[model samples]
Target: MYDIQTIFQTANPILNQMPYPMMILNPEGIVLAWNRQAEKTFGYCAEDVLGKFIPFIEEERTYFYKDLWQKIIHSADPLHLESITISTKKGEIVNTPITLKAFTIDNDRYIFCQFNLGSEEQQDLLSFNEFTSIRDGLESSFMMLSIDQEGLISYANNLFLKYSKWTPKRIIGKTFWQMFPQTPESSVVADAIWKSLQNGRQWKGEAEKITKDGQSYWVDLTAIPIFTSAKKPSNFILLENDITDKKRLQNRLEKIAYIDQETGLMNRYRLEQIVNTMISENHHFTFVYFSIDKFYSLKELYDDQAEQVLIQEFTQRMKMYFQDSSMARVSIDEFVVLTPLGEWFIQGFLTYLEQHPIYINNSTLPLSISGGITKYPDDQISFTHLMKASYAAIQKVQSEGGGSISSLTKADHKALHKKSVIEKRLLVALDKKDLKVLYQPQLDLITGKITTVEALVRWEDEEIGTVSPEVLIPIAEETGLINDIGSFMLEQACLQAAAWHRKGIDLKVSINSSVREFRDKNMVKQVRRILEDTDCPAELIQIEITEKFALEAEAETSIIQQMKQLQNEGIVFALDDFGTGYASFRYMQLLPLSQIKIDQTFISTIQYQPKSQMLIQGMIQFGKSINMSVLAEGVETQEQQDILTEFGCDAIQGYHISRPIEAKEVEKLL
Candidate 1:
């Protein structure tokens, strides 16, 4: 608990220095301290307000005040009451805006209030009568100067001399314009001020002036022309407040907006600004994007200081080579340049990189730069299109194994733009339930029974209709949206299977899983959660993966552990498109696969090719020898099904059985 004396003693010196009027009150609305500015604004002395209820709350506004105070107490943001009418000590009504904030000191809460005596807009100095009435009140806080009709300083006060670092004798006879040099910006402000004063009008603005020691400072200046008895101007009086600290802070923030902190180069925003300016002028230039290969690995190998030194050294090398270009660091490892140089520029840089490698940390780091080039007015007309084209070209170089450069082509840009659109809209499709799950039945070849169906994802977007799985799956995997899409498919499939189970149909639904989806360590937990939420039996769900995914999963222990956990929960696992990739045969011993589906390529050719039929028979015998069921996909004719049935395949799924259909259609088929 704090006494009133301690609160006042701790808050007095700081409150008095503030430019605005301020007061401190206890949580119970008793006034504790009022600063000097408040006394000047409201004509109330501190002695009259201490240890008493607030004196300004009108009887008609009691409810409004209570509500505003309650908001201030409960919210972290300050509450602002604008233009509240109040009566001053002289019984004069005035409209003032006040801001209130709740704070704590010594475990006790208090409300701090600030009064805005004037509106935020810049206002001219008061007239002669009002100025004289408030001159004494303003003298203590403002810097004052009086200039004659000749623009020579006629009088300067102590505050003005103190800030300008000038003595009385040296400053009294000097011209005002001499203090501010005739720079482009200063000349404009000087003309405006002179014109306003000559017209007998007041002028208010911020100005930059030099001190005696050649240091510069900014001031919020207001100048009023003093008129004589004949209504003619005699002199002008200027009042100013030093705003040097605020201007310095703003300058620093502007520098940060354009400069990259790490390498002292321009940032992406500055790069875009320069490019847009060039485009507006119709200048022909080439845009080049570059990235360091395997930068993350190198960053992990080095310490922070070594990494910073390496990047700085790289930047220096680039600056030295591309002397005529404007460069920017867009990301940690990526950089962009805009130049008038043509194809030879990129080829020459490649040769230069080969001759010189970046050296740091007492180690020779093998460095290679991957770049993409696009020309303005040739490849793209706008800055945004040029940047996208350059990025697409760089992606091509990276996809072809990095350390080279590529130029954007019309076809390549179109395809990349389409893929980018799909990547962005795929998640939105999932959220809006625009994607659906379709089921394809697998017939048991031996019993002539339909016991299982494969769950496939299908999408028909409003903008781009009917995106096939071959195109959509790769985009989803590259953008990492496959995890969300995979989850959606699993939940929908499980719900359908649970519904079928309730109708006395023991049907198993197979969902394709990606290696990227299983990379998540929570996959097993996610599977359990979906099963519990849908009330579906674990045995009714089968997860399918391609031979490529199976080979990749064999080396990842997390994927193997998650698979075994799901297997223990009675979920089935199958390898789809088994013969399409590296079978490794080691997956047979390592993975908990219960079934394998032969790819359609071999199945479609089995009737025409003797070698394909022999291979299909061998695969069936191999699967059965390991107690795993063999299923053949894409059988279209009765002859193809007969051949697969004769080969002792356990099941077959293809056009011969049925095409993939929706859940309700599958129910009708059952």
Candidate 2:
């Protein structure tokens, strides 16, 4: 420690004698000091650089240098490290890693610095190699071309030169229209590209291009806009690929799938797809399915070639009427059309087709077609239902005698009357339990003592009190409410029969079954549940089915067989409304019928109508021959009962003794 100032002054020379470039700049950006390493690295002598302003690198490649300086100077605590590029004399570029430190000596600012060039040169060299390798190895027939905002080419690549058949020097700065003067300016593909560029959107399409030799070919081109940092498009990039053969194969496949080979119209598969799409999109469209009237007979009358010619001529005439429609050949003699029209337009079009006869192969074929028409978003919610409604309507027309167009109206009056009366009351009845079971005591005619009772359903409406079962029962059957009503009646009757069993009466009761209820797949299950719930002997519960309901038991053969099996367990079935329909005698052998109830129509007329008496007598004799019990219904007069008793009827149930009584009232009778 001999003379500290002298020792510090001696250490300064060694600090500045390092092998790397080093310089210190003041806060005012003036170069205050430099070393011999700085002089050699930057190609400036220390005497020439010490008092000069530091060179501001203005090259676009080194623009970030200004930003780096501002960041360090304005920061409250200046940073000590940064890497930057600087331009040298002789147009050479070098990168340097620098370390800086700020120190204040005399209330003014100062900075100390260090510099190194150890690893930066290697990084620059590696970056340059990667860029060149990628630029040379791309093989997608890519071209780097720049286009001005005014649609003029400013640059072109080598690949573009060979494809355009023009030298790069000549075509680099030409506008597209000027280079290909004969190209169609108003073509759809060209207009799309121009529109995209004007709107600053990317455009892609197949376009026709002409070479310098005037040879034309198809090319798929994609044009993308190059955006600046401000997000405004500065130029465009156009990439093209040859696609002629690909397009030809696509067109051939489409023809095979959609075009009808015989009629040259759209095939059924295409028509179905179009209809499905239209329905999915909720489009307002009208569909019409039609078939040639008597076409099968016409084919028999004429030869195959003649029929073909007739069909073609018929289709042509149909096309004339539905010019703006989608026409398809759905079958040999059936055609369908999808149009955007109202009912009036469709009716008028069909009328025109019906009135015009076609001339085919030097003969008048006099063809006519029957069609069904329906509108979209009105009649159905899907294509399947639309086709179903149309076909059902078309079948209705053809079955009544073809040769006219038909449209679906609301359900017919009979069906509506049935549905309205039944569905409205059945819903309310189920909630209110408005349905009551009326028991008509079935007597042994010989002893005149009640042994069994028939359970008849009587509807007591709150507003319209006590509706006759005849009117409401048919209504219920047609609306599919009969199954519910029948089950309710069965449950009530079983409970009453069980109560009668407890009272030592042991009287069996029967309930009527409708066509719908008898054919219901769940009929046996419902019956089993009620019997099990009530704990009634199965023999004490009989199901009374009408002769008309028995014929509809085809699909329910297994159910009918189940009923017979249950009959073996002591349940029974009576064929009610006997002699009311045809083939009553035939069904007796087919059905396991325990009893036959003669309808009231013949019973009330036995006094005046001799034919009624004879029919009743014949039914009784028929029942006797079959060894089946015959019960007479609607006996309103004692003379009628005496007549039934005289005829040796098994049971009598009518107003002559007592109308159907409720369970509570029948309990008193018991």
Candidate 3:
């Protein structure tokens, strides 16, 4: 056998000369020997480290090596190879696998170890390669930086150098604060990184960055802190991703969602959101709801293609007039503009729209709009209330005739309140049976005998005196109470007319039906049921509808056909408010009728305006030629009465004959 002393000495030299790290400890866990590889791996030579506690390698190693020594001492077993991380003198971390063996020499216990340093460098090289591959593969502009605890940038990638307008030589030693000094105080990136380093955590978020060229960009950043062998932070690794294009794309999508596709203006959905937001914020603003006049007719004349061109041209003209106003397309033919402007500006804009004509595809389309304006915190506070007021104003202008714009005034509010009151009372009145029908007799002009009775609706409230048909009728229509009220009126009228027939008075009873009631698909069925229940002849019930009903093509066709069907069953149809609408002559030719009731307007102005008299005469002649009877309404004077008789009017009705009377008074009148 070789000499033990020589073998030990020769093996010790080879171990000390090895390029890897190695250490030897006694059974009591004291550092007995260390090799040159250990010195290079740990930045400590054998002289300084020998005889020191092996746990002194790191704070974590204190418990780790202590347990290893205790296990070896108690069981006399060697520990298999294991991986561990330790700190070097320069504060660099080295991960290595180590093996320990228990040996004895001269009756003393010792633990020998072999450490591998190349394993850690191989891992670090693989990680570096992965980082470079990831950085190069990204399509978006990006940056990577490694920062030390003292805030000095130790490394920067190629992309970072390009974006910072600096080379790696200049940026490697510079701090972030030095690179971008004008960064806003609100920036939390540096603070977040510092917090992560102190707490050994990770952080990520989007941050605003200002470049060397003073241009601003958005970046998404992720950062991780590197730790030492003692589990204390040493440095930070940061990855930055440019997200400016993503932000731009998100903003563009949001804009597309809220804007109208054709006009590129705010859509109704956006308008509603704005109105609700304003109400929630209690901001004062004004809104104008406007509908283009003759828009439907124009749409019918020119198809959707031409209509789109007209709308674009109209929006351009409106923008020129309103300037900075926020406009939106609220409906197919309606545009709403919300503005902080006063009445003068709104009025001027309306006037400008009224005067201009949209030139669309070689056609000069007349651009006229009827608008209703309501102000916030002044007209109403609730969004729904404001919208109602605005729409009410629009309806007012539409009813009075188009091509006009009106603002909600004190009188308008008072009128709305009155209507509201009437609507409430009308509901109660229906339940309490407070609604009644009054009769105005229509007399044969030649024989001076009552030929028919006109049924007029009347309501008496306990709080307010009497509500006129003009006021209560519209309220009922808007509130959808017309169906109930009309049913009551029809039942009452039929019952009273049946009572007259019981008295052997075979006269037709005429009852006015609103356009809303007349257009109902169930009106004919309901009327037939009423006649059957009251035991009255169908011929005794004459239903009157206004001229405005004929203007709506689809609704009018349905109503007229239903009426003709009922008339063929012996009921009669009469056109009320004659010569008041655009298509009266066409309606006369198309509808089945028994009489034409001249509108009160022409009758009221006949004595003053010759044009009114001539129009009435022409209408009376047209009625006679069609073999239809003509009745002049609003015949309150003998002069008016005589003129109607001279013009060959068949019947007349107004205050002159008899004001509307209740069912009891109708018996005396007959």
Which candidate number has the best lDDT? 1
lDDT of each: 0.83, 0.70, 0.74
Off by over 4 Å in 1: 1-161, 166-214, 218-263, 267-285, 291-317, 330-334, 341-370, 376-388, 391-405, 585-590
Model 2: lDDT equals 0.70
Q: What is the lDDT of residue 168 in candidate 3?
A: 75
What local lDDT does model 3 show for residue 91? 74
- The residue pairs in collision within model 2 are none
Q: Model 2 over residues 1-670: C-alpha lDDT tens digits?
A: 1132232222234345455576655565456666677777878665665555566344573335445544555544424344666666655777777655444433544444556561122111122235346655433456445678888888766766666677777777777554333646525566678678778777765667665676565566667676655466777766666554444433433443365555778877678788888877878988888888888888786675777787787788778888888989877788888998766777675567657766655676766678888667766555665666777678888998877788777663234334455567778997778787778877678878877888888777876566787778767766677778877888898899898888887888988877666556566777888899998888898888877777765345775676677687788888887878757355565667888889998888899998988889988988888888889988888898888888889888888777778767766765
Q: Considering every candidate listed, which one attains the maximal TM-score?
A: 1
How large is the C-alpha RMSD of every model relative to the true structure?
15.9, 31.9, 30.8
- Estimate the TM-score of every prediction: 0.63, 0.49, 0.47
Candidate 1 matches the true fold with a TM-score of 0.63
- Model 1, 32-66: lDDT tens digits are 87888888888889887887777776778767766
RMSD of 1: 15.9
User: What ranking of all candidate models by lDDT puts the best one first?
Assistant: 1, 3, 2
